[model samples]
Target: MLNRHIKSHSQYKKHMCTFCGKGFNDTFDLKRHTRTHTGVRPYKCEICSKAFTQRCSLEAHLRKIHGAALHFAYKQRRDKLYICEECGYATHSQEVLHLHLQDNHPSSTFLRKASKKMEMTLQKKQGEDQTENSTADEGSR
Candidate 1:
């Protein structure tokens, strides 16, 4: 992490924001900064419907404003939220997002293709898990 931070300071910024021409060493930082210009607040509060550009900002809002406590196990990160770019719909599960896209935004070709890709990846992962289990079983026997 220290090395990454050091690299960010020393290295030339490769990612540039089109709106303001601000440069960032990291793509994630560039995207986050771009959101400030685009007004694309992806992270939203479920209770108040207030949105934020970053997930951490939303989490802080939930804790401070809504009096919500976010509990995570030691060294465990929060679940990656699947957010709908079309409607600001957010979910913890990709399967839920796939169903949401199918039901609400059937006309979205890009989202549909993304859902299919996710499904294919999941199927591949399941196949790999089964193969590993079978190999382990053979070795144990």
Candidate 2:
């Protein structure tokens, strides 16, 4: 990752935007940048049914507009999903999505740097389990 960051400082941009001639060191950035020109809003809010170009935008809309709380316990990792922008292929496993990108869309700019993992959000199932356990303990006491 450090090597990739160092390479980003160089004059070379491996991924170039077809729309505006913008250059990016990582293909992931280029893929995200292309969404601006393509107007492809892949991330959709489940509550309001509104769409967004980025996942963070959707999350912010959920928090701000829909009053959704995104609190997570310490050291808890959230459920992750990797969706293909080109084909709408969604997967819970990052490795599966990576393999799909490599095999299906080799020419596309969705391939990110090796060893870089996307930040995950918390899952509701674990919280529910904790609640259930606490209730059981209180009943036993």
Return the TM-score for candidate 1, rounded to 2 decimals.
Answer: 0.62
lDDT of 1: 0.80
Candidate 2 TM-score, true structure as reference: 0.54
Tens digit of lDDT per residue, candidate 1, span 1-141? 676687688558787888788888886687678777757788878899998988889989999999999887776877788766556677888888888888889897537776787979899999999999999999999
Please, what is the TM-score per model? Answer: 0.62, 0.54
- The sequence of per-residue lDDT tens digits that candidate 2 reaches over residues 98-127 is 788889888765655311443221245567
Q: Tell me the spans in candidate 1 whose CA falls farther than 4 Å from its real position.
A: 84-141
- Quote the RMSD, in angstroms, for model 2: 10.5
**Per-model lDDT:** 0.80, 0.76
Worst window of 10 by summed lDDT in candidate 2: 113-122
Could you tell me which residue pairs clash in candidate 2? 78-121
Error of 2 at 136 (Å): 38
